[model samples]
Target: MKSFIILPALASLATAHYDLVFPEWRGDSFADGASQWIYPCANVTQEKSNRTLWPLDGGAVNIHMHHHWTYYAINIGIGTLEPAFTATLTPELHNTTGNGTLCIPKLSVPAGLAKEGDNATLQVVTFDSFGSALYNCADITFSSKAVDPTDCKTDGVKDVIVGAEAAKTSTDTANTTDAAPTPSQSTGGAAASFGGAGAGVVAAVAVGLALMI
Candidate 1:
């Protein structure tokens, strides 16, 4: 009976979703995992008073992934209230494997997106292998002092491959060469590689926790 009970609990942990680590979460969603599914900010309507000071040029975004594989998209909204997420920070959806601390250092802020002393919100959307979408966000204040790149590090994570959805979109675009390009495609956005910023290197760090589950 004890063995049976433990198995289900372990399974739950193994299949858990991810959490935004850097900046800061709007509220505590870890206690009730299902709440993370709530759209646009995981049901956390109010922003916290203590916002993280992100670099005006760009900064790091870190997350703790529970799934062995997941897809991620990052976006930014400029404002103090109900800011519209008008900018996508990711060039394409990132497909990552392994489960632990995953960090993207030096994610470049688009030109004129925001300036120092502006309050903005950083949003991270994710999809697991099961195709479930989860949302998490961090409230930030742009600052001239940049975050140290060394602060961003991974414990157990790796960029496995191009995201399936992104790959399909690329193929579809190629097929429709004459079709008008989407705003995202036209911008030539940049994607910050996992583990290091813009290195474009696939890396796998040893798992730190005894149980990834």
Candidate 2:
């Protein structure tokens, strides 16, 4: 019989990958293309003004990375309703003109930015423009691998019990089935995603199972 325990075991192991997604909008002229993506994050809020002089418009880039090398997906600019407001990563600087670059002080898309511990602030930016300088705000989300990970918790005792029972039921049915058995695996990866709370729930289930044995 395949190792049934393997399913939960797969929970802990880590993987790595990268992705980039951004919303675009119609451009000013025909040549400027259909649209542009301003920030790469889902909901990016930028407030550019004086007082902060790190990069364009005193904007900041906050990266809250964690364990393992994380690949980030960034949204340059979501679609815009305004005609003149073209949101996209531009190479423009402050006090300049001409259809500036979408991303400000555009940083070279890092060749595989890694590590949860890795941190940086994007206060000031500099990118090549036709003539002037502008501000920029880029949004990003990271993961260890390309496949999207679920943000589900281990649930609770009820959920875990339901899952365990469901797992056992599926196994027992396959045993008598005419079709060949594929295999069994652990519930690591996603299980661990339950954050810190998952550990407790899994431990409880294990203890409860031991009693039954």
Candidate 3:
């Protein structure tokens, strides 16, 4: 019985929930909140629901502003940083930071999050605790392994590969999709061919075909 219980206990410790949140972030600029640090604390639950909030281990989050931005990071849920996890953003480049912020200037509901209601990033981290990132002097140098961190806390690390890729890909797809044809812009005769009359007639024909198909 003792042996049987050991594996289960270890497994449970091996996995923990991570949740993070900034505030409502009431403005269109990062500068509005740049002076104050928003201390994030996890609001955690094993319960499954649209409104379950996970707790962060630290009593209240400690954040600061450096350079041109205010930054915050929370474990969201606990997990090993031995191998970092990945989260994606649609129509944007992969963030490559474990510390995520809402990016007030480019705020939008994260693609599939509409059913859940409001969302935000709250902080920006472009590198890992090990120091490998799109931007930075690094918290730690990536070598055989980075089991600890010096400059930055190592709750865990995250890669924005998926989010960034989705953002860009979605944008590209949208640009190509549902576009109005510019055949009218192609030739010197474009004015004679399309800029003349019947442009509405052409649009109507296109719509009719789309509906039929």
lDDT of 2 by residue, 1-213 (tens): 356677554442211111111111111211232111222111233232111122222222222211132111222322222112222222221121222122222233233332332222221222121111112233222323322212322111110222344445555666668544344422432333333343544443322222110
State the TM-score for model 3: 0.19
Worst 10 residues of 1 by lDDT: 204-213
Candidate whose TM-score is highest: 1
Ranking by lDDT: 1, 3, 2
Q: Rate the local accuracy (lDDT) of all candidates.
A: 0.68, 0.25, 0.26
| Predicted structure with the largest lDDT when compared to the true one | 1
Per-residue CA lDDT of candidate 3, range 1-213, in tens?
A: 898989986663322211223221212223333222221211211132122121221112222222121112221211212112122222232222333322222223233322222222222232222222111100111122212112333233333432334345444555688753343323323333333434553443222212111
| 185: Cα error in model 2, Å | 43
For model 1, what is the C-alpha lDDT against the true structure?
0.68
Q: Which stretch of 10 consecutive residues in model 3 shows the poorest summed lDDT? A: 133-142
Candidate 3 C-alpha error for residue 114, in Å: 3.3
Reference-based TM-score of each model: 0.67, 0.18, 0.19
